[model samples]
Target: MRQKDNGGHVRQEDGNVNNSPPPTLPNLPSRRTPNFPSDPLQILRPDSSESRRAQLSEPSRGRKGASLAAVAMTKPQQQSPPSTTATTTTSPPPPPSTPPPASSSSSLAKLPLRLHSLASSSRSLLAALRRSPVTTLVAAFFLLALFMYGEDVRTLAELSIDDYLYPDADFYNVSALPPLLLPPPTCDLSRGRWVFDNTSLPAYREKECTFLTKQVSCLANGRPDDLWQYWRWQPNNCSLPTFDARRFMEKMRGKRMMFVGDSLNRNQWESLVCLVQPILSKGRKKIVKRGSFNIFYAKEYRATLEFYWAPFLVESNSDNPNFHHIDQRIISPERIESHAKNWKDVDYLIFNTYIWWMNNEDIKVRRPNSTSWSEHDEMPRIETYGRVFKTWSTWLEQNVDPASTSVFFMTISPLHNSPAQWGNPNGIKCVKETLPVLNYTKPLDLNHDMRMYDLVAKVAKNMKNVPVSLIDITRMSDYRKDAHTSLYSIRQGKLLTPEQKADPQKYADCIHWCLPGVPDVWNQILYTRILSKSSPPSPHPPLPPQ
Candidate 1:
């Protein structure tokens, strides 16, 4: 509201229209605004509607008639003694010294009446809001946040299944590339719910996976739960085929399929190895681990399924699979060649990198040519991520042969470190958990989520020739908070014992998925994609050249 100055020039109440709409006022949004508002999302969004509403709410806008609340704001309170019963004569109020000439316009006459009604309504709303004075100036912020998230989600709706899988940056110019090795956009496999099918055994028994690392072997580690292993991800519209180990091996006869990322990918790699291990005899297959590479070779088919530990997917000190410290994390984003040379020519390439890069502070990065390993520059996370992908995308354009190679990006595997995510405020991280989150409709995620899918999707879109299909296993995996290798898993290369399991907070491994569990479903989805189109013959006649 404006007041007349001694010199008669009006000044703004707040010379500060706060730069970003001063934190939303206590839910100023009232849909029951029949007597006042007609604009949409007005209280939150400081556009023309809000500006116009503010004008009507101001007492100065209607000098002829001030609202009840407006008069209270302008006046000060003073305590006085109770009035005595005494008759007193009152003088008539004086008129203004210089009254304005009367106007004949109906708009001027009717304006104050409308403003009075709106001002009263605004005062009533403000009074209700003032009862609970919070930091927020408006309640519409929650609505705005939902609207934004809703908008961000629908951006993908423009994309087809092929586009979702194999994003062509130039959505208009897709014909330049060869045919994508994905099924037509019929039913979205990513948008699905989990099903309980304890009717049969899981893809593989825990005891039979001889090569399964003890880190992910929860059942063998002596945990008491098994319901996490029985659930299968079922697509809402389409019936996915069961994983056939023999058929999958047959398709990759003389080729290589590698899972290249962090331990989560290693978790998937172990799941895949276990899935197909039963088909071959012991002598026919063997797993070899040397430095960062873990290979499981099939003697008969000459096929290899491997897992490479490149958490950052670039040159980094943490590349060594055996030993790496979380605190002393470092990377050379522009130099991926050290690790790229290993899995560059693989027939089926599955990639994932997220959890390792999620640090609260800036990341330490070194230049590729630096001789002194001690010298480093601290770079922000997202910037470093962008540079790493830029190098990776450049490498893909130069090295990968789209005709022979089918590239895949496994989406970020979700972690269940917070019990509050699943509506259990009292529970610990993935410990004593039995079943997968059954209710898909419930808000089982954190209010403040850190999803890197957008960045991954953006990077995939910018690729020119290479068609990297996204095996969108994030949302589906998010429901499996029960599937993580919690306290039942390993710590520092050894499994946790009974006494150690008692303290879940210090020992829980929520980042990695337990075998015969979530990763099996990931493989099921991967298997679905694998069966869609047969792989082309390996360009290098017998895979890794003799």
Candidate 2:
């Protein structure tokens, strides 16, 4: 029998129909498949509608088939409908056995789920916070404190003596320890003798140091008392810790220490330099002089030791280094800023001004607004001293930060110009004395001018904020009558003539103490005071076992 083909072509309806395939339909170019292959396998494949229909209808597929179906569900197929069919048919797809690979649409579909999960977590956290608000605030505060003080806490855990030395009760309130247990600094320690020991002779040789004033260089001027070179200050009650120059430099690293006062302070300043300079290597030290200010820099430590010559400790006409007249000294009692402006930002300040005030019988003070000088005649020296100290104290209270600065007031350095004051009628001055007054029992009578000692002590005691230490070198220094420069002091770097040297009473320098002498002991006391004020780390408590 003959049968008509779907394309209206003649075809025999026999078993050979399977062997000879029907003619292929013309393939219109599709957007998805622009270059469709004309291969027989591609043409023989089932249409998308039929394939999806088979997958939907067959419910008992094996594991392999299910996996294949899952892959097919994930990858969408592209199709082009035949022109003969007016409408295309599509079967509903089966539910995916496994989720599709991540894509923009898939990610968007999961966004709502993620948002719901986040909202649930946030609600739980809020509920927890509401239940324990105090706990939450405390935890936050603890975290903040830890962030701020973490390093300081760690440092306190591992403190060493090399790092710092603890302060005593004199500097601050040490209420933790009982009064009996505290080691108070004794006055007997300050009143000891200078014993002969070649091992600890001169800190720096006078011949080598160029910083020494010609007036104080007794060793260079051929003094016969080599015993003075070997003599060391020995405190009666407590031993003074030998000054460690390296340790001192380390402590003073990147700091500015200044001596603000008269040439007496300059004497102590030179002594400190001699004490520390022996440790400095070549090219490690430098000296800079500008007008009345002299600065010595230790390059390795970045430390500066400066001296500003302000004899009155306030503004004075005698402030000039070269033009300061001994008898014509003029002071402006309130005008301190002209001198104090340079003293700002100092880490340590050592001040002395008692000797200059004693030069004139009447103080020539310039009034605040007037050009004429007013004489403060026979004004009890203590009252005059008190006014000046009040001005200084006011300046300190206003300008100095107690947390950053350490201040010291050296007590009056006694002068031995009159040997009659110390009960030696035969000797006119300190010219021929070879040894210190060893067994002096009577306290020498220092009159009203020396009453400034009690005033300074009272002022320091009364101060509540800034603690100024009074270095009382007077009593101990009074015993060292043999330590002065005397006739050995140079006059303009020239040896005294026989005529001038004969008059030891006139040419004797009983004012300044000799270097490698009593000034060293003064510096030692200064060192101890400095160490006593430093708030070093305490011993940490034992940690509890985990």
Candidate 3:
């Protein structure tokens, strides 16, 4: 019979000379068993140093037999059979009395040298561990880390592009989870971290969207890195739903959605068009410029996404989205009908106006029938801003039907005008920033942005007729110092020149964000409101009714 010694190598034992049948053998691994990584030591126990050394030793008594393990796993597809002629011998197989066959001798001869070298290396490793424990530990750690990283790379290599863009599409049970478009009543949508996930982010690609204006197309304007496109917003307790453009369009089927306010609203309006455009058929979609509105129409669904240029949400001298960069700005706070007239019949209305009002401490207020700068009164910005919003609110209360039209007031979109605010003291503006700022020692509830945030919420709460949903994005926006268009955007209707990009302090366009970046996330929040048909809660408490 064939038997294994303490070292686990096979040797022939004595048997009946005349009547013995072919010796019974232990189960041996064959060509059918593929050993991955094809290393001889893989079969040994990882924690047993003695067994490792023993496996590398020659069989006892110079039996002419060997372990056959290394040769069994040498080739993945085909390996020559180990010599089995000794198994049928009548007496115990012994060392050859004369010179053996060349085939058998050469194969067995080279194995001992290989085993001797391995044994010597194993002893040296043990001696090193004993001599310098710390050095040996560090080397072992590095080797282990290398092995794990190689495995991760191998796993990632197997994924396809489809897997990258739609990973978790089927992971959530849609019917069981909260409304795909609505935040839970208690869920704090504003409290979240920006998660790095290359698989399913960016919401859309910069090159794919035909609706983008050059002002927000940072990637096309000589900016280099594309890593900014791979972030997903993860709330502290809940997750935003996976966006389904088809479903959103179906819900807004036969409806008109208008975004009314400043260029910031127009930025958001452009994002919505890009997101919903891919799902529309080529000839079925078209955009038109009509008066103060840029309208995107989905013919099959009969849906219109309209943007109206109303920068203070009331009559302002800068109301013209094009050619609104006047040296002096003026507003007629009470005269909002020229702007609100277009918004009265819309099914969904989203409004935002802040960055334009922040340029000067005092604003020029022109009363009715006053067009000249000579007839304007310079008032503190807060009072003028407050009265302008009040005019917007009063129009909402008396002009539109609450049951038919939904109103949403977007809070301030914070600015990254200073690069020093984020750790770059030598930097001039939002350039070369690829990640959102995350480590705030305290929550962002005490800045100038929050002051505007409180005022917007307080105004919305005071209204009794209109159920206005305040999309408070300011707190979350404070952390995104890296997402602005900076010098990639246009100034005075002209794309920034090389000289302007070089001088960020004078021409860095920090007022707006890059498309396929922050604005995409903003629309996801907007889509949530249209999805659930329920008002998303505001982060601030409403003031007491007087």
Candidate 4:
């Protein structure tokens, strides 16, 4: 086990600069092997300077199809193959702060779609057709088929099919099925359980309207701009009617709240800090990192907000050169609990690990025992992961004292990469398409992509008082479609082009939400859930300086 200083931090090796550099922590390259675009918003372009009245006032094509076709005709030409050198983008640092617009969800929903068309020469197609029309058509057909298949796959996957199909699928070999958590004994108190303003908050800036559920708002206090006062200014009712931050701190003061996972989890951590920072004086709330974990402590409350980067949460370092070339495994279950052995002292624990596991090489996605990737056999067969998590769950059941400690497992954050949903399939990740939480009653199976759901549910059933709560952020995020950082992260200097500044969606981030962005909603949900039971210590009534 790594040794820790009395302060609860582990010291790092001197020469390990890149891996152990000071905390605090993008770019799309053109050439340089055509790297992935860091800014997801730039992929789609919606006209901002022009007025909707002007376009409609002087209508060119009577039919919507004709107008769309005309817009397509004016699309920019894709850059040709580079002669030798490559091109890349360096996204600028984030802006200091900004004011959000005042618009209700309904008005935001009526926004128009941002459309872009690529101009390909007929000659280019003819030459390729002459060479292999059949091949080109066949490839196109295959792609179309795949998308069609994906749609069906997504539909089937989203449904509540866990019971019927996997009746005997013991999430953990030790556990059977878990009971269904009905929406809440009834709708009144149920609605009050975790309800925020009961309306969505607007995006920090204007972005595209595509892929967004027309009227959804980003959850209030979910963004930096929305909650900066609460964090710094120490405002009351920061989590009013639903969550009461002061009450939460009173309950959790001197206790701990640990969010374990990858960077996405960190995003939520930062959001939470921003939400609560204002409660304390400058330097009173400090963030310090020592070894494998990082902690943010509010001295007034004696609460430490900690983060442990255990994407896999189990030890799986690269023993092989190939694995090292990809990602080094870091945890071993046998040795895993050692890092978090102190977790027993924690008052609350929240965990997540999904996107990191999506990569093919990370773990043996397709087992050696399986011949091919089939829809039927596509159930994640990470035998080793299954065993490790099972052990982890069993560990939690044994370790945590339900009376004092609460545990939560956040759902997989969704990825919006498709063209039909976001309009800028080639350009953005999850940029400006901010909308409200969708109200679809459609049952979508979260099995295929989120293989951990079943395992977690099964684990929950077996654990006695832990009452593993599911922070279902997936379905809600899937609909936001536009609320990612996308291309904004790639802009290099503080200053940006008029086009860049005007197009908030193009410049915003995709992979992770901004400080006052979407993740704050997750933290708010967490706050509501944890505080409902007990009141945490307040940061007020300042204690002597540490």
Over 1-546, each residue of candidate 1 has an lDDT whose tens digit, in order, gives 221111111111112221221122232232221121121111111123344334334433232213322322343322222335423446564232222233222123344555676799878876787776561346567557768775433332221111111111121233453543443558788777888988754878988777777777788888787888888777878766677776677777767888999878888988998998787643446676656777776645656788887899988877667666667788888888888887666789999888877765478998658985477889888778878888888888899998889899988778788888787889988788888887668545642224357777887888889988888887788888888888877666566777887788877877788789888888888988877865576665443210
- RMSD to true structure for each model, in Å: 30.8, 35.1, 28.0, 27.4
lDDT of 3 at 528: 77
Query: For residue 44, what is the lDDT in candidate 3?
Result: 18
Q: Per-residue lDDT of 1-546 in model 2, one digit per residue for the tens? A: 222111111111111111221122233122121121221111111113343334322433333233333433453332322334234347565333223354323323344555566799978876787789896797679879989976544433222110111111021223342332212565455566657678877666776665666667788766778565556777766676666566566556656689988877888887888788766543345455556776776644556787888888988767766554566667877889988977766778899888877865567777668765553334444566788899998888888877888788998888876667777878877888877766667666533265677888888888768778888788778777888887776654466677888988777777776777788878877876776566332222211100
Candidate 3 residue 270 C-alpha distance from true site, Å? 0.8
Q: Which whole-number lDDT from 0 to 100 does residue 331 have in model 4? A: 35
Compared with the true structure, the alpha-carbon lDDT of candidate 1 equals 0.66
Q: What ordering of candidates by lDDT runs from best to worst?
A: 1, 3, 2, 4
* Candidate 4 local lDDT, 1-546, one digit each (tens): 322111112221111111121111011112122221232211111111243223332323133322233433353333333324333447664333221232222122223222112123545755786799787898688779888776444333222121111111111221232331222222222121222331444222222211111112233212322321122111123322333345556555556688877667766765676566554443234565544466665555555677776666654442221123233233343445654564655667888877666655334432333443221122333555576677778778777777667788887786665434434446444444444233434533323354566776677677665668777676545544445544433333232355775675455444565444566667766765664554433322222111
Error of 1 at 372 (Å): 2.9
| C-alpha lDDT of candidate 2 relative to the true structure | 0.62
lDDT of 4 at 414: 69
Error of 2 at 475 (Å): 1.1
Model 3 Cα shift for residue 266 (angstroms): 0.8
List runs of model 4 lying over 4 Å from the truth: 1-242, 318-335, 361-382, 421-428, 431-448, 490-509, 534-546
Span of 10 residues, lowest total lDDT, candidate 4: 16-25
Local distance difference test, per candidate?
0.66, 0.62, 0.65, 0.46
Task: Please write out the lDDT profile of model 3 over residues 260-353, one tens digit for every residue.
Answer: 8877888888889989988765434556654577777664555678888787888776765555445577788888888887775577889998
lDDT score for candidate 3 against the true structure: 0.65
TM per candidate comes to: 0.64, 0.62, 0.64, 0.48
